[model samples]
Structures are given as structure tokens and as C-alpha cells.
Target: MKHIAHFFLFVALQILLMDSLVLYSTGFCFIYVAFLLFLPLGISRVWLLVLGFIVGFTVDIFYDTMGIHAAASVLLAFLRPLVLNLLTPRDGYDSGDAVNIHTMGWRWFLAYTFTLVIVHHTAVFFLETISFQTALYTMVKILLSTLFTALVMVILQLLFFSSKRERMDYR
Candidate 1:
């Protein structure tokens, strides 16, 4: 339920808001990737895959890119649990904790999100570009865009999400 709502909101934001963000020919990034980063750790793989497909397809519709973003987002979703396990905290996670500064601590969450975001962006850019002739430039764009988007995601997490062990709600 929550995941479905989140997926829709992120896709809508990516379609509408991502385009308005511009900077230095690479200063902007669409933040829909945050959905994967912030999702609950225990969500089923099938749910994650579906979330990825929906988010991707929605962006595909908006971008007219023939589901490229959907494919990339699915790739990101597939990689998410691997990254999470690799970065799992020793203290253990609460059942409904949001994977952000609040739950994972700022340092751990930053490292985790940054690493995953880079991977996601790398996959997205290279796949979208699909050629090494312009790989250098495309890599630069991916890095800058990843930085911008990751920064936005971190800020938004800190600002919007409150991981209360008491109530256990994202809102």
C-alpha cells in the first residue's frame, strides 16, 4: 500500500519536477531513485521488482524513451538488497525503519545511499548512452547528476522522514 503510493509519487515527481532542475549542463538530477533507497528493507523482491517496473514505465511514458528508465530502475531495484546487506548495521534494524539518516545514522546512510546512487546512475547513463565513444562525457554527466540527485535525496530524507520507533510510520 505505502509502496504503491510512494512509487506513484516518485514517478510523478520525476516526470514533472526533474526536468525543471538545471545546472552547469549537469547540475541537475531527477530524484525518483530515492524511492529505492528509502524503501523498507524487508519488502519482498517481487514487490521491489514491481515497484521498479512501475516507476520505470511511468517515466518511460513521460520521457518517450521506450521504457529505458524502467529497465534501469529495475536494475537498481535488483541491486538494492545486495547493497543493503553489504552495508547492514550490526545493531540490527527495526521492523519499519526508513533507511535514512534517522535509522542508519547519518554516516552509514550517506555512504550507503551515495554508493547505491552512483551505481544506479552509472547503470542509467551508460545504458541510456549505450556506447563508449562518448563514455567519458557521459560518465561525467552521470557523476554530476548522481551527486546532485543524491544530495537532494539526503536532504529530503533528513527533512521529510521521521523514523520513529514508537509509531512506525513514514509520514
Candidate 2:
């Protein structure tokens, strides 16, 4: 229930707000991937992929970018488990622990977020352009857009999802 709401919230924010921030004419910030990143660790991959497709399709409907967002999102979902395995701690991830800054810490969160965002942006830009004549331009777009999106995601986590100050009670 809660995640469903968040899914819609991120979709709304991405389409309504972040989609308008065109940087360098070839780059655009996409913060909606944050929703996919924050899904619970124990969710089945099938559900994850389905949810990714749905979310990406929803975003595509608003952004009018055909299936680009859906394809990128599906790729991200496919890669998520691999990324999580590569970055798993010595004890492994708890079922309830989300892949967010509060649970994973800053360093792990940044690496995870940056890698996934870069992969997503690379897929989106290259697929959307589909030509080697503009390979250099596409590369620039991927890098810059990945950086901007990562920065925004981190900032948002810091501002809205920080868990450091949560009040605890001692009886």
C-alpha cells in the first residue's frame, strides 16, 4: 500500500518536475528510478520486473518517449540483484532492510545509485539515438545526466529520508 503510493509519487515528480530540467540540450535528470531502488530487498524478481515495466511505462506515457523508459527500467530491474549481490555486506542484507541511504549507509548507497543510474542513462540515450555518428554526444549525455540524477537522488534521500535523528525511547 505504502510503496504503491510512493511509486505514483515518484512517477508524478519525474514527469511533472524533473523531466523539464533539460541540461546541455542532450541531458535530462530522471529521479524516478529512486523508487525502484528503494523497493524492499526481499521482493521477488518477477514482481520487481513487472513493477519496473509498469512504472517505466507510466513515465513514458507522460514523457512521450515511447518505450525507452520501459526498456531502461526493465534493464535496471534485471541488473538490480546482480548489483545487490556484488555489494552485499559480510552478513548479507536483512529481509526488511531497504536499499536506501539510512539502511545501506552513504558510501554503499552512492555506489549503488551511481552505477544503476549510469547504466540506465547509457541504455536510454544510446537506444534513443541509435547511431554511432553521435556516439560522443550520447556519451556526454549519459555521463552528465547520470551525475545530475545521482546528485538529486542523494540530496533527496538526505533531506527526506535521513534516519539519523529518529527519536528513540528508552524505558
Candidate 3:
């Protein structure tokens, strides 16, 4: 519930400011899909889907893009646990800890976030494009946008969260 609220707040900010940001030619998409990546490790699968739907639906409402955000977000939510399973050791994750660079480590979090971001961006762009006539350009745009978004997710996580605090909480 707390996570969902934070995501909604950030999505609101993104909707209001998305027009002001750009990367090269592509726009910077700093959304709360990062929250999807950070869901508690022990959460139920049903809550996972529900939270993804909430965030994605909220983005859809703000951006007026229909189901694109919903599909991409749900996909990311579904993939997150798998990525964590692969990246973190069997006992590495805990339900109480936040999923940030500080808690998950930079390499693990980056790889996890990047993979999900690329997957999400690909689905979103292709859904919006709904065509592959210029597949190369579309691919480039998706890659670039994903890269920028991933950076934003990481930087935000690092800035907002620090390892020392997480260590105290875990202890």
C-alpha cells in the first residue's frame, strides 16, 4: 500500500513534466515502473498483479494511452520475481527491505532494472507504433528510451536510499 501510494505520486509528477524532458531525440520516460521492480520479495502474486495494474492504469489515465501502460507494467511485474530469483542468492532478498541499489547492490539492481525496462519499453513502443515498417528506428528509440529511463531509476534509487540505513533496518 505504501509502495503503491509512492508510485502514484511519482506518476503524477511524470505526467506533469514529461514534456519538459528529452534524451537526444527520444523523450525521457521516468515512471514508477521502478516500483514494480522493488515490490517486497515475499508479497503474494495477486498483489503483484494488482499493484502493476494500479500503476499502469494510473499512467494510462494520465497519458491517455489506453492499455499500453497496463500491459507493459504487468509484464514487468511478472518478470521482476524471476529476475530477482536469478540475480539474488536464495536468501538474499527479504520482504522488509527496499529494492534499491543500496539494498540489492548496484550490479544486481542495474541488471534487473535494465532488463525489465527494456522489456517494458519494447512492449510500449511497439504497441504504440503497432507497425514495424521502420523497425530499426523504432528499435533504436526503444533502446535509447530504455537506457535513459533505467538511469533515472537507478539515480533516483541511489539518491533517495542509502546503504547505511538499509543496513540498520536489516539488522
Candidate 4:
């Protein structure tokens, strides 16, 4: 139920709002990827891939970029587990843990989000260009966009989600 609402919210946000936002003509905030990034850590890889494709396909429909978004999103989904494994702490994630700033702490969340966002942006920018002619420009776009997207995601998480630590501290 919550996921359904989030799906619509993110897709609408991307199509209606974020699609027009371009920072300095180089940074693009693809906040839709936040949907995939914040999914429960215990979710299956197959579901992640399916959801990634669905979200990307939905965005592609609006952007009219054919399937470039889908391809990049699928790649992100495919790489998510590997990134999680690499970042796993010695104690491992709890059974009910979520991939969010609140649950994982700021450092781990930033690392996880940056790693995945960079990969996604690289695929997106490179696939869109499909040539090395503008390799430098593409790299700039990738880095700036990654930073922009990660920043927006972090802000959104802080604004909407509260952690156990926050709740306990409030008392």
C-alpha cells in the first residue's frame, strides 16, 4: 500500500516536476531513483529489478527517450545488492532494516546512495550520448547529476522519515 503510493508519487514528481529541472544545464535531479534506493533491504533482487524496470519504463514514457532510462535503472537495480554487500557491516543488516539515512546512519547511507547514483548516472549519460566525442561533458553531467540527485534524496529522507533514534531522543 505504501509502496504503491510512493510509486505514483515519485513517477508524478519526475514527470511533472523534476523533468523540467536542470541545474546549470549540467546537473539533473532524477529523484525517481530514490524510490528504488529506499526500498527495504530485505527485498528480493528479482523484485528490485522488476520495480526498477517499471519505474524507468514509466519515466521513459513521459520523457520519450525510448528505453534509455529503463536500461540505466535496470543496471542500478542489478548493482544494488553488490553495493550493499560491499558496504555491509560486520554485524550485517537487521532483518527489518531499511535502506535509509535514519536506519543505516548518514555515512553508510551517503556511501550507498552515491555509489548507486553514480553508476546510474554514468549509464544514463553515456547511453544517451553513445559516443566518446563529448566524453568530458558527459562525465561532468554524470558527477553533477549524481551529487544533485543524492542531495535531493537525502533531504527528502530527512523531511519525511523519522528514525528510532529521532523518536527516542525526542522523549
TM-score for each of the candidates = 0.89, 0.92, 0.88, 0.94
Candidate numbers, best TM-score first, in rank order:
4, 2, 1, 3
- Please report how far candidate 2 places residue 101 from its true position, in Å: 1.1
Clashing pairs in 2: none
1 versus 4: better lDDT goes to: 4
Predicted candidate 2 versus true structure: per-residue lDDT over 38-152, tens digit per residue: 8877778999899889988998898789999999999999999899999998888766666668767888988899889999999888889989899998999998899899989
Better of 2 and 4 by lDDT: 4
Please give, for residues 1-171, the per-residue lDDT of candidate 1 as tens digits.
766677777777787888787778865576787887778877778988898887777777888878777888898889888887887779766656667577567788878877877887787777778899998898888889878988888888778777654234443
Across 24-135, the per-residue lDDT of candidate 4 in tens digits comes to: 9999999999889887777788999999999999999989989899999999999999999999988997645667688788899999999999999999999899999999
C-alpha lDDT values of all predictions: 0.78, 0.85, 0.77, 0.88
lDDT of 3 by residue, 89-146 (tens): 6567665666767766778778888888999988888998899997898898888888
* Clashing residue pairs for model 3: none
> Candidate 2 — number of clashing residue pairs?
0
Candidate 1 clashes between residue pairs 3 or more apart in a chain or in different chains:
56-70
Against the true structure, candidate 3 reaches a TM-score of: 0.88
lDDT of 3: 0.77
Q: How much is 115 displaced in model 4, in angstroms?
A: 0.2
Q: How far does residue 26 in candidate 2 sit from its true spot (Å)?
A: 3.0
Off by over 4 Å in 4: 165-171
Sort the candidates on lDDT, descending order.
4, 2, 1, 3
* Strongest candidate by TM-score: 4
- The C-alpha RMSD of each candidate to the native structure, in angstroms, is 2.7, 4.1, 2.9, 4.2
